[model samples]
Target chain A: MKLKEIAHSRTGDKGNISNISLIVYDQKNYDLILEKVTPERVKAWFSESVFGEVIRYELPNLGALNFVMYDALSGGVTRSLSVDKHGKSFSSALLEMEI
Target chain B: MKKIRIGAGAGYGGDRIEPAIELMEKGDLNYIIFECLAERTIAIAQEEKLKDPTKGYNGLLEYRMRKVLPLCKEKGIKVVTNMGAANPESAVRVILNLAEELNIKGLKVAAVLGDDISQSIENYMHLEVLELKNPLESIREKIVSANVYLGIEGIVEALENGADIVVTGRCADPALVLAPLVHEFGWSESQLDLRGCGILAGHLLECAGQITGGYFADPGYKEVPDLWKLGFPIAEVSETGDILIEKVDGSGGLITTATCTEQLLYEIHDPSTYITPDGIADYTAITMEQVAKDKVCIKGGKGRVRPETLKVSIGYKDSFIGEGEMSYGGSNALAKAQLAAEIIRNRLPIIGCEVDELRIEYVGFNSLYGTKIGEVLNREHTLGEVRLRVSGRTKTRAMAQMIANEVEALYTNGPSGGGGAMQSVKEVVAIGSIFIPRSDIHVNITYKEV
Candidate 1:
């Protein structure tokens, strides 16, 4: 099953970096997510768009994991020629990751 | 048992007005906060100011004041906002005049200035821009606006001086909500924990409807009811900095632990250390629980001492973008779209443009993913139609417009079934960040009463 089935995500941007938060609907699924969703896996999953390092932070209380991807916005909303200037669709793109 | 009710109104400059009106009418709000300015907005507003001094503030400030001031007077609700994008003093005057026209008595309006550091920006040319490798000197000629992200100082001062409406430029989004908490409960600079909690509350409330299910709706996955009539969020805060985020009773949108958790992580990096001018917030300890229907209580946020320096956003003229789109349908639609893209690619150079970068995409297929989405996308059946989009970035506006003109010419010159052509050309305003000393920046507040 896809991560979207058990978890949801939202993408935000600042400068050239993009931050995506993945949260599980159930607290029981947090461990499964934590075990499978490693920073290396995420970096490889988004290898096409993400260039710089990917840092992952754990929010145990909220059953969520936040991933900060650097050099992700193609120089950000101002100069990015991408149709999705703010990378809004990246959240949906992240949901496509299989667990 | 001291508590206050604050409504989140107008998350951005172009936000919906009806939800804010709903809050004003029925949310029973003691205060309403609107966080409207973006990083690139003030730079564009600064350019507009050069064209007309009276027009630098948010374009909808007049319309918002006209709609909310009369209700504010009747309901005795205070207003705080960063709608004064490039000019706060002028925004103050606009509100004062709006009060007179509406005949709303005893309304005091205040404006916070000094966020604009452009005149003295030369002194900081040696500082390193956080985003770019270049120093300030490289973009000095292209600089249009430079403004600091102020904390609660200016807004708190306005509230302390008995101003019913507070207007400011370039204040941090969380500061718009945190300032009122400081003024009402007498939160001191040393009360870092409470300040942290308040800033966290501000962050959750800053985006308005996002906390109340505007962005959380997914058809079969996560369901949010009555999303079309989405309601903005309201925060009920105790003196100890505990908060309950909810919306008006019977109003649309859902408020649950899930929604609250999503919003808590939205637009934030380093959840443990969120640095602001007022305090450095630690969100790791935060806990959310559903206390009642459409309400979630938040608690246990940590905080540290405030930063010694403030962040400044620098806006500069970047470049120009030109784009055009045309669609082709019927048999061999994919082939036609590919041929159209090839034709445009060959013709863009012939048209003569100093192109820095360019993209040719088929709208239904590769525009978003930018490449093949595995064999599934390739294993298509009965392809109907595809739109070809060509976009380019150029240093000159004329050169950029030439790309759009060339694509437009494809209708009569190149393709057979190309239809519904659309094009656009605009100047790009980019943003840069730098840290400046707190002591070097000054804030000035002016108040006027009706």
Candidate 2:
């Protein structure tokens, strides 16, 4: 199943760093998400677009995983020339990742 | 068991005001706090203050205060907002004047100042932009506003002094919520568990309707009802720091575990160590329970020691962005839009325009995901109509205008059947973050009666 199949996500940005959180609908899917959605995998998924590091933090009680993508917003919202400057759609883009 | 109900009025500087009014009227809230003034807003507000000192507060201050102040004053509901933007003193004066106009007597308004640290930043030996690692001296000439994020102390002081309305500048969002809890519950700064719980409650209510399913809806999958009349969030916080989340009765939207969980993790990078001015709150062990419809009970928050350094948001003149867009419809629309984007891409170099960055996107196809959607676009798809958007940023307004002009020329030059051509050129005030010692900043709270 894809990440979006059992989880929902939201995106927020600070400077060039974009933090995307993925919260699973059911607690049972936590292990699957933990195994499939690693920082290394997220970095690979974003590849060249992310200039800095990708860090993932887990909130086991809430069944959520937050991925902080550094240097991801091109150069942050006010400076970025991209249409979606805040990287708001990055969560949807990450949902496209197959499991 | 002393408990107070608080409502999150406005989330951003330009957020809808009607929902906040609804919250004030129906939520039975003791405090209605507006979390406006983001990093960039204060910078722009500072520019306004430089020209006319009294004009630095939020643009909607008068409209909102006039509508809600009398009602709030009558109901004994304390109003707290960071709408002061670059000037809390000016905001205080505006609220006081409004109170006089409404004939509302004995209104206590408090203005919390000292967040602005423009002079202090210059004294640092070699300041580096947090996360970005950029040198501070590079953009020093263009710095418009530099304000430190004040914590709950100033707000708590204001509330303790019996201020009916509190206005502040550049305060941490959660601090607005936590201050009331601290003032009401008499929670000391060392009560980590209690403070942590307060922080959690505040974070949930900080974004107004976001917790009540405004931004949580995903249509067929995660359905939310009556979003058009979605109600902002209200938190009934107990003296012990326990919280029950709900919305105004009969208002639109629903709150469940899904909505609560999504809000808990919003904008948070590290759940274990979420830093704020008051202390470091850990939501790692956080848990929530749905007790009833449109109500969630939140518990199990932990707090660590507060950081010695405070985060400062520095706003500087970035550049000017010029954008142009035109729509194409009927058969082969996507192709024509692509051709239109190509024309803008090629035109810039020929026109000798110096752009720091450039972006060309086919609106319906690849405007958001950029090249990442290449794999999906490779699959079978059909686009009946699409829009071509071209934008570029440059230091000079003339250069920015040239980029937009090139796209306006597309109506007659090429890409036949292009219509609704639009062009815009605007100045960009970018934000950078740095950490300064907490000792370097001092806050003072003053109150006025009307």
Candidate 3:
């Protein structure tokens, strides 16, 4: 129901890479969500839209999932012109997941 | 024979330059360049312009300018800067007036305009040629500040037009040095490698003699001799696109391989794809050697083709944020602060109030730099403070104001007893960029007599 709960539920301390907590809301099946929301499972869930490495972890304390996406941003945060730092249109892809 | 020295100071926020001024007086530097504009600064400038059009220009920080300009004028050193944000013409007008008041003669002022592209944003979006994926849909209604970052060509044009002081808005940091190179050498824009070299030169000097020492010097902050009188920065650009990063005589800060390498790596995310308005420069391609004491020679900087389109900054109204602070006096202050934040979050939503962002920071308990987290357990409370910050769009006024009121009331329930409350939440405006085709945006370089 809350963002912090979502973040806390999906946190993991992996080697060389730490899982950053993120919250994706589910308006319909908020209660039906399962416990085992691994990064690999989350990546497979959004496999169609995601281009980079999507690693997910479920935080038992907060009941949330955290994901660390690698190179998800086109050109790594900068476009052809280096002055701007806005990444490409990937938010819709990010917002479509069922959490 | 005395060397013609130049010092460039990176400008950001109004700070005193007594040390730099003192150096200029003693060193006899010929030119000084000051740079100050980050992406965040651009956002803030746009927000201000939306609130009041006349107040957005950064050059209006005349307090800092007043202190340095008169000193430079007296010492006969030329200065170039991009402090003119939003309205450069108005900024120049003020500076010229200041020149007159100072009784400084021959103050050649030049203005670089035509970068503002707010009107043509719609036309560019409709074309659909360059895909702007997740554009800020909400900002379309009230876009405030929009300025394209120009290149060194404008700076060169200003210098060729006989203007001594070139004031610009949102120009690339390296353009400060490249402009002088273009003016002196007449290098064409198509010379990508040469332009890249010039940009590299600008990047080196843009920090205002920073390469020589300011921030890259030894630990314990050993005082450079007569640093109180340190110069800005000046580049001796050669016809071959070679630049000598040097400072005025008798100035402090060492220019060595270590210092130069440190400065080159500053704020750089990717070494290979270092982008500038001019072109993409390869930092690895650069070769440096300490040829002399306090002198670093940089060469072999490679550049690639520049992108066709220009990026424009767009800002829109977002939300109102309210913050309140109270000093936690009793023991276990950190626990009290955390509990207070938890209480606010849990109770705010019950009263028809939603928060977008809630941050509870213990200033003394945590380190501000990098991502290091400090332990917040079992610490004696000598002097501690807890600040609560919350942001939200829906809770614009009444709801956001109530959050502030609640924070103050926490003194009875909060751990620190009754300390005080401060209002911190205000409107949150979001800023993004919309690239327009080269044809839509026009860059006009004009020369006017002063």
Considering every candidate listed, which one attains the maximal lDDT? 1
**Second chain of candidate 1: TM-score?**
0.97
Docking quality (DockQ) of candidate 3: 0.03
Q: Give the per-residue lDDT digits (tens) of candidate 3, residues B117-214.
A: 76656654433222234554534665555667787667777788778778787877887777776676676767878778877877777656556665
Error of 2 at B54 (Å): 1.2
Cα lDDT of candidate 3 equals: 0.57
Of the two candidates 2 and 3, the one with more favorable lDDT, higher being better, is 2
Residue pairs that clash (backbone atoms under 3 angstroms), model 2: none
Task: Give candidate 3 regions above 4 Å deviation.
Answer: A1-99, B1-5, B23-28, B42-55, B59-61, B64-76, B126-133, B136-138, B209-231, B246-256, B329-331, B365-372, B375-398, B417-421, B446-450
- CAPRI verdict (incorrect, acceptable, medium, high) for model 1: medium
Q: Each candidate's TM vs. the true structure?
A: 0.97, 0.97, 0.71
Indicate the TM-score of model 1: 0.97
When only the first chain is scored, the TM-scores of the models are 0.96, 0.96, 0.42
Model 2, native contacts kept:
0.74
Tens digit per residue, CA lDDT, model 2, B419-450: 99999999998898888888998999888998
| Docking category of candidate 3 | incorrect
Q: In model 1 chain A, which range of ten residues has the least summed lDDT?
A: A84-93
The DockQ values of the predictions, listed in order, are: 0.71, 0.71, 0.03
